[model samples]
Target: MTMELGLLKALLNKDFYEKNRGLRCPPEIFSKDVRKIKDCLDLAMEKYKADLTTEDLQAVFHATNKTMTTATKVSYDDLFRKMQSTKAIHGEIAEDALSSLFQQYVGEQVAQMGFSFVNGEEESLEPLRRLLDDYKNDFTPSIRVDWDDISIETLMAANKQESQWKFNIPSLRKKIEGVSGGHLIMVGARPNTGKTSFHASLIAGPDGFAHQGAKCIVLCNEESYERVGARYLSAATNMTMDEVHSNVSLAAERYDTVKQNVRIKDSTNKNLSWVEAVVKHEKPDIVILDMGDKFSSKTSDKTDVYLKDASIYARNIAKQYKCAVIWMSQLSAAAEGKVFLDQSMMEGSKTGKAAESDLMVLISKNPQVEGADEQDTQRHLNIAKNKLKGGWHGVLHCDLDGDRSLYTS
Candidate 1:
């Protein structure tokens, strides 16, 4: 039989200690107001003449209402007696219990002070994962992985199967091929620049190698479902350019290869929250945010706040899901010629987006001489910064065909 009086004393003592100290007593019981748990165990051992096992300490540590939810068969005194039997293991157990208890009691206060988690410790977890669990459960936040996390082995694997393929392999321009995970690709051009056509070619033909065997989600903020559908139809049908717009329904059958696979949406979601939800649900291999300006928050007018939120929103979703996001951003007037720092072509809030982006590509119409013919208006894709390669730069080609948004090298 257990002494209910001893258990009562322990409970009463706990109350008294917390009252005076303005804090709950940790399991270690070493706080200024309370004696260490080891001392309590010693006193209980002398009083009960019973030896406790290591398992007994573990059981007691978990059993205490102070730390755990469930009650145990052993009285509070039995916990003391058992802990005294194995000082070393009990001490270690007490330490863990104490740390956990301390955290539970003080975590809220600590968070108010703006303390973050220690990396490589138990704190690493995703933010959304924490909200759903109970303290009967716990969660941690995971850090975002940068380009450095890509091991040489993974790079080698991404390259090994390619180099030797046949059938023209339907290669895209070097610019598109160079994009990888965790990048923010801004492909912009004057009206009719083949942005849509290029993207369709990627999704339907071999040029879309970046998306091959990869699950992709395209968010078409500017176009409706029917308009975008027709483009996709053209890419799959091998139909002449004129025939595609005329008979789009004919190409619907070929989508069987990608019908169930390729996820496309042609709706206007200005805030981009809808995109976030889709990313969470589908876990697509690549996500394309058609345009950047439409996603800005209403409360913000400054580019910093706007892009900052956009970056936070996009990066968080991308990192959490471990997928690539191809975000299209518009450039400003001066930005049309050269890639400027912080403010070049991005209409507003570029600093935040540029800072958070793993990579930035600048697209502009190739400079034309005064008398050049209309056909001479070529486009240029400049590698503004390839953060993964430590800020390297390169160039590619872009061309916008009339009415059809077919982007080509």
Candidate 2:
């Protein structure tokens, strides 16, 4: 019957509520008679986040408004009937109507201000200027927020994606669960400490990320693309280069299973901006930056500032593109001939790289024997920083099969 109840009905429509629920349609616009009802509707919509029926509002109001008097109850029941008989308007027409009402309210405030100015209750035009300035951005509602689900139901279900994209390495999986989208995992090691092979094993080896159905792209600025491609070849077939040459047909057959998932590019002389462009074009599920530190230019004399800025860009790319980024880095000479490594051992800058990463796995090699000619295959994966799954920090022992370019327990 009343325009207030009709406006309330339009607010209940799913399309209108989703667009104009927040500060755009505050309960202050409603008259005192149905203002409480509008407040009830606001609370219900936020919790339920669904198109609510007339009965739903009545239930929510009564269930929450338990202390009301009998006369007030009868008046509210009459108001509900008026809302029930009203039809909701939709689309652009509804939005325009709502905008008109909000502007009318703003006009009423200015009208009051004019009265005050005329009656000598106000001095300068400063109050009117301040009022217009404050309302400038309220018309558009420019902020689009994606509210996180805080329900107890989301506590475990929030991690469902990570579990779906499970890690293939059994030992590492036992510590921190797996990585999903928005993960920046920085892998660091000395030059000959299987730096390239570690990723080759996790990405190209049997039962790796590629086999797990991830679209993988490797951008190598350190090694030639051909060299990186060869490692991937050895990893996919679990064979040495010599063995692959001898059994080309069998290796090709084995590589074919995950060949479509893998892509290698020579990204030499490229910066983070170029990397972002490739990511935007290809839209891969997993990205690897072999030698990720070289992506930044030394704009400042401080190595820490530039390196930290580069890592920030890398982190943003991972989050915006909804992909997991594996940043390959080299450890400094302080880490050489050492059995243990930490975040401080990362090359170039001290804490810049580790600070931005969600997980930092610093790989260290075992000390060499006095007369041994063979390179060390034993590695200790020190998880210096972990913000994923269990948040565990410790070492996991694994062996790097250099010939096959695979790491195994």
Candidate 3:
């Protein structure tokens, strides 16, 4: 008869109906909840009628309170108010009496709503599909752009007259092209193999990405941002490794030059949401995700769910921003051998990260040399795939010194 007990009954009745109407919960679910709530209420009423003494009432109070609290996972205020008016266990007793009770039946019914799907279950797939569909359509065309006046011929003629001539003439003549427009390029290698240096070289070296009108955002997943900057500065300014440490001013100059073309960012926290925000805001043509391990540990399980979700995120960012999204993926055991070209090597996430990528490049240590000159020709750059260009594997490019922005013959 207490206000709290009355509220408990109301809550249980409502909760039972709400849970049982679902696709998963059935009539048995509701019946179980009802029995639990009813049992607790009955015990509380009997205790109240038997004894009005503080200790006696406290026992009944505790029992009835326990029942109501466990009967349905409802809030305390409503139940307490009801008990105060009807059962009349007013003031401090009702307030402090029963606060910690929660029912297993209620929890069982509610926990299902929070469960996550494993792998490619229909529940998981549906949301992912919708997200992908939305990404494809999110970037609307700017209204003021002269769509009617745009033409390939006109664009080509304009390019012929503009500075783009520099970019195109070389492509047309030597077939050597430069990447622009927030393009993502991946440079992968095992630990301490100069992947960071390679990225720095591309952004700061004389003939690097900056010269090609590309601003590089280097996310140093493994190292501190300052360390990455030092390496890049040393490479770009042509300073001796020792001199870079002694001359802070030279490093500053190199930093300025780097900022002009490439904006360096670090991914030490394992969160990629920052990278996505940078892409949307800065719209850099060349965004390098550095190594795949930096894309947050949430995707670390290598499950089908993780792969599909992570790959879709990378691909959508690339397509939405009209930039090349390059993810640095690890090769599987097979990739270490001749059969490594298959998608298994991307560590953590599935092969979809590699397969969905616009381009996939594998950087591996060259096993050929063993003598004095071996250090000079240490690493081999394999263009394992260019999915945008039909997944073609090109000739191997070697980086001997590993100081150059690019590897060449």
TM-score of each: 0.60, 0.67, 0.51
Expressed as tens digits, the lDDT of each residue in 1-409 for candidate 1 is 1222222233323322233222333333343212334344444444444455444434444444365324433444464564344233222333344345555545663453334444333454454244233321222222234556478998787655322111111222332234444455554544444556555665655445332566777787887867776676566554545766567577555545645556778758657687777888887866777766576566576666867788777877777787767677666665544423233555665467766776666656655468866664355656665555334466655454434444444
Rank the candidate models, highest TM-score first. Answer: 2, 1, 3
The stretch of ten residues in a row with the least summed lDDT in candidate 3 is 164-173
lDDT of 1 at 311: 76
Clashes of each: 16, 0, 20
Residue 216 C-alpha lDDT in model 1? 73
In model 2, which runs have C-alpha deviations exceeding 4 angstroms?
1-144, 152-155
- Scanning candidate 1 in windows of ten residues, the lowest lDDT window is 162-171
Candidate 2 C-alpha RMSD relative to the actual structure: 10.2
Better of 1 and 2 by TM-score: 2
Q: List the candidate 3 regions with Cα displacement exceeding 4 Å.
A: 1-176, 182-186, 246-255, 296-301, 333-344, 368-376, 388-392, 402-409
Q: List the candidate 1 regions with Cα displacement exceeding 4 Å.
A: 1-37, 40-96, 100-176, 209-211, 238-241, 245-260, 336-343, 367-377, 389-391, 398-404
Q: What would the per-residue lDDT of candidate 3 be over residues 77-183, giving only the tens digit for each residue?
A: 34344444554333333322222122233344334433545332346456545534543442232233345555899867644532221222221113324343323
lDDT of 2 by residue, 1-409 (tens): 3666877887787677877776677777778878899999999988898888988999999999999999999999988988898776655666676777777777888999999999999999999998788676566533336998888778767676764456667798778767877889999998888888888888898789899999999999998999889999999999999999999999999999778999999999999999999999999888999989888877778988898889989999999998999999988899898877889888887788899999999998888789999877888999999988779998999988989989888
